[model samples]
Target: MEGLTVKRAYHQHCGLAAAMDVLGERWTLLLVRELLLGPRRYSELLADLPGLGTNLLADRLRFLVARGVVRQCGVGSAQRYAYELTDTGHGLRPVLLELTRWGLFRPELSTVDTVRPRWAFLAVEALAAGRHAEVDEDYEFRVDGEVFHLSVRAGRAHGGLGPAQPPSVVATTDAGTLLVVCAQPTALTEATHAGRLELTGTDSAVRRCTALLTPS
Candidate 1:
């Protein structure tokens, strides 16, 4: 028999190893997280995800596309390429959410210095489980120059990246302050009063949206 070279696999025949086969590559999951909001241009991903090298990002995108975890699409007439998660990639949401929660609850595992605007998506989804809503309310949250929209309606929650049309409430602040406001009632009140966080809307609307999006 002729000798042949093969890529290494965990070869354990276990589910965990199978999952690692898909996601254990460096930066694979983080790239998935970046695309979770919506399709993203290569430059946008680079800007949002600090410390990732260009070549690595490109390689990971290629790997993901080949695996059918992500797909490439054209953006408008400009013919720019955007990368978006495929259905299988979007399926990693719950898995990533669990990891996010685990990291959030463990103080040593998280640091204040590393906060990012997109993290608010994870926060909203984590705490949205028990939120109650009678009517649809849209909120636009601006954190560190990025905008995210969250809506609550008929006891359900929906959110995505970018601005909301005629948002019921708009809150603007740095990412760090937003995290504080989301997690602490005292900080939320103080931030509102101190102008550290700016929110526009009727008091009731603001209050309701806050209740829905704040982390529990």
Candidate 2:
């Protein structure tokens, strides 16, 4: 807990308070996010969560390890190291998930997914300003993590989802791009025809996919 900090005056050394002590740092939450898939070597960490220096990474790793949030394992004779989440660290998945869902946009997403997912709550708000009233069909939206999925079928927008829900249309754009396309600028058709969007299923499937992203 050497580098850990407590910005909020909550209980200490246990439960939510303890988590905040380490995770309160903006980068720490991202660190948890970078490691969410499982284990990653230091280089991989740098790759996924770029902009973090080795010294800062070492500090975060040590802080996480000290707080029981992560563990380091030695790989082969190369003496390389990989960082992994402990059970406690794994528990932070939902925290980061909720944070992502709640609209956290790093500055890196203006044009590309890049190393960071630059998104904004305003982008989502603009897109979701008005949703189609009654959705009843099965639609898939390959949207980035920051935006919520709303499929308009029989007319009403659908609710939350599980991983089983296959996206009818998959676009490579992050939430920001998705938001931009849905709100203004590009039409789903144009994006698809232009190759920014790669349609997987039939033209009808592509149409249905577009409908999902259609602005309310």
Over the full model, what C-alpha lDDT does candidate 1 score relative to the true structure? 0.75
Model 1: how far is 125 from its true place, Å?
3.8
Candidate 2's residue-wise lDDT over 1-216, tens digit each?
445532454566677776566677757887876666557798878776767888887778887888788999876788678988999887765455445434533323455445333332223322332344343444434455522343445544433333225555444555455544654434556666776655565677666555545553
Candidate 1, 119-198: lDDT as tens digits: 75566654553465575878888887888887677876666888988798888887777666556656677877888889
Per-model C-alpha lDDT, please? 0.75, 0.56
TM-score of each: 0.80, 0.55
* Number of the top lDDT candidate: 1
Root mean square deviation (Cα) for candidate 2: 7.6
Q: How far does residue 116 in candidate 2 sit from its true spot (Å)?
A: 4.4
Clashing residue pairs found in predicted model 1: none
